[model samples]
Target: MTPTIRGFEHHRVPVDGDVSLHVAVGGSGSPIVLLHGFPQTHLMWRHVAADLAAGHTVICPDLRGYGASDKPAEAGPGTYSKRTMAADVVALARALGHERFALAGHDRGALVALRAALDHPAAVGHLACLDVLPTLDMWDVMHGVDAAVGFHLYLMAQPPGLPERMIAASADAFFGHFLDRWAADPAAIPADVRSAYLRACAAAVPSIVADYRASAGIDVEHDRADRTAGNRLRMPVTVVQQDWGAALGFDAASIWRAWAPDLRHTLTGHGHFMAEEAPAMIAEELRALLTR
Candidate 1:
């Protein structure tokens, strides 16, 4: 069986008429939604959510097309676009009785949270993004050699059928490669938790590919439009990232500052899966973000 946040209660909240999100809610007071990254479930936030729930209501939901959440077939670019996923998040919070809440996300989830802050500024009181750049800036900064690090992004960006087939053929090996490679300490993710992440990812291959494909297409367009309109995040924002700038040859802080004027960018020594590797530090960063 998969492990969950110790004190949280799970619910299937309807974010759309045909789509419902598998969400975990715990604690009391003001609400804060925690979104999980790629190849993982809401379980990634297990440690951080539990810590935050002591004082604030923590909502951890597996995003659309990941984990136990509803994975609708991709009918168009909008099907898995960050804009749509952001809407689902807003609906989830509203259904749970929060008209507005603080928000935080890691990796792919960070992209979604960024969109939510942009499109629904009034609904997100504060924002925290971990280990990712805005979609437009991401594509801009990735150059020849450094772009190889994001090979999967290019692979999944292909027209639907091929990327889905290649990944699904060796699902465990494909998904497990990330779980193994991205963590600074392999043991940071316990065996059970790791297995749960792989299982959730393998079972949702097509939808996951669709999610990434949308990033390459519709997501970029949205970000471009936002930039053209000078639409910046109005709320205070926090960004926690590894010092990837040193190796990737780009200034991470300057990139994020373009969209977020009230930003606090912290560089961490942890790997991509920092939440699992350094939960205490991540939780503290989030607590500090909430106060801003």
Candidate 2:
């Protein structure tokens, strides 16, 4: 049986003309949307969403091109760009009767949240990003031998055909590599959740690669433009990370501060999949962000 948040009800909410998102919504009061990261689905937020839902309406969605959501072809650079994904988030909220909401995201979703907060500041009351650097700073910090840790980013950034075919040939291995590597406690995922992640990722190889490809191309351009225009996240923002800057030899908080002036930067020892590894703590941080 597929695992789902206990009290949450699921729906396919239409954001674009034919693009609907697979969302699980529960609780009441002010709304809060949680976006999942790469190689995973909204299921990643099962624990945290349920906790936050106790005090706030929680909306957990399989990001377009991930999990059970619609995966449109990579029409162009705009197709899977974070900018487009961010717009989908805004539309989803408004469609569900939330003009503005607190937002939180992990990994790739963090990139989308960052874009959403920047592009639709009026629609996001507060923001929280987990375990990712801004696209522009990510490229800037990663160089030389240390950059090898992010081998998948470079692999997926290639032209459409090659990366897709390469990843598709050994889908499980490619997708499971991160699931196995990034967790501090492998049991945090258990057997069922791990299987779900591998299955979902195997089925969405092309769209997933297209998402990363856009980050390397058009996403960078968007972030660059924002930096040039001196645009910063206008709302209260909280960033929870693993201190990647120490490993990559850069100041992570300083980079985030440049993008989010009203920022609360924090460090976590719970590993990459922190939401799964430390749900209570992740929920606590998000709850605090909502109060800010």
Candidate 3:
């Protein structure tokens, strides 16, 4: 028999005077915050969170400007930075009575997790980054045809009004294109989940584009500052990624080592959406990371 989904409780936690997040929390035990990436919602972690919740409390939040979260029209200096988003995660955890927790994030979420680990080292006990590189290295390594892999990065990185306007004009096509291209098996994403994600993206087009735009601008500055200051993720770090470096002629582990000294890097054959495509493997990785 399929187990009943205990479902999730909606939460509105203030991150700043004018900003707050729409979070979903369920289960009970040691807290484990699962953050979703771009073109998806916290619902992406439904399978993994349900499994983890058996032994741990799971907190899943739609990052600012995505899903059910507030989408502020203004993208101020601190508004969309990963650093600020990380702080939102910390605030959400604290509001939920978890001063410290194990944190894991995929794609864009991984970037926020990394920033959280750096910004609030005392709050994140363990860190797991799935399928991303540090922002600067990601930009530094891309070139010519190889850069085509992340074409959206360049498109969304463009200055202000244009990118958002274009994306907003054809939001479903813009968001669905990545959803279709990145998944190894589209069937892994259920119909409802797909529709939900597309709807969220359509509704949060400006903020979504702003989030990526920051990655190309302020986020890069933050990563550079961290590197220059010799500040690395000061926690046990587990990274699961496809061998993008091998395809593009670079050392993936070496790149990760620059940011995470206590690192366990695994190259999986899984596509970008490892959580959905390979739940068992993703769970196994998370279990080992949390245990270690």
RMSD of each: 0.7, 0.7, 2.3
Model 2 segments more than 4 A misplaced: none
* C-alpha TM-score for every candidate: 0.99, 0.99, 0.96
The per-candidate count of clashes, in order, stands at 0, 0, 0
Regions of model 3 farther than 4 Å from truth: 1-6
Question: Candidate 3's residue-wise lDDT over 64-143, tens digit each?
Answer: 98988888874575679999899999998998899999999999999999999999999999999999998999998898
Candidate 2 TM-score, true structure as reference: 0.99
Residue 288 in candidate 3, Cα distance off native in Å: 0.8
User: What is the C-alpha RMSD, rounded to one decimal, of candidate 2?
Assistant: 0.7
> After superposing candidate 1, which stretches have Cα over 4 Å from the reference?
none
Q: Answer with 1 or 3, whichever has the higher TM-score.
A: 1
1-292 per-residue lDDT for model 2 (tens digits) = 7888899999999999899999999999899999999889999999998898888999999999999999999999999999999999999999999999999999999999999999999999999999999999999999989889899999999988999999999999999989988989999998888898898999899899999999999999999999999999999999999978777899999999998889999998888999999999999999888778
Q: Write the per-residue lDDT of candidate 1 for residues 154-268, one digit (tens) a residue.
A: 9999998999999999999999988887889998899999899998998999899999999999999999999999999999999999988888889999999999999999999
Candidate 1 TM-score over all chains jointly: 0.99
CA lDDT of each prediction against the hidden true structure: 0.94, 0.94, 0.88
Residue 24 displacement (Å), model 1: 0.6
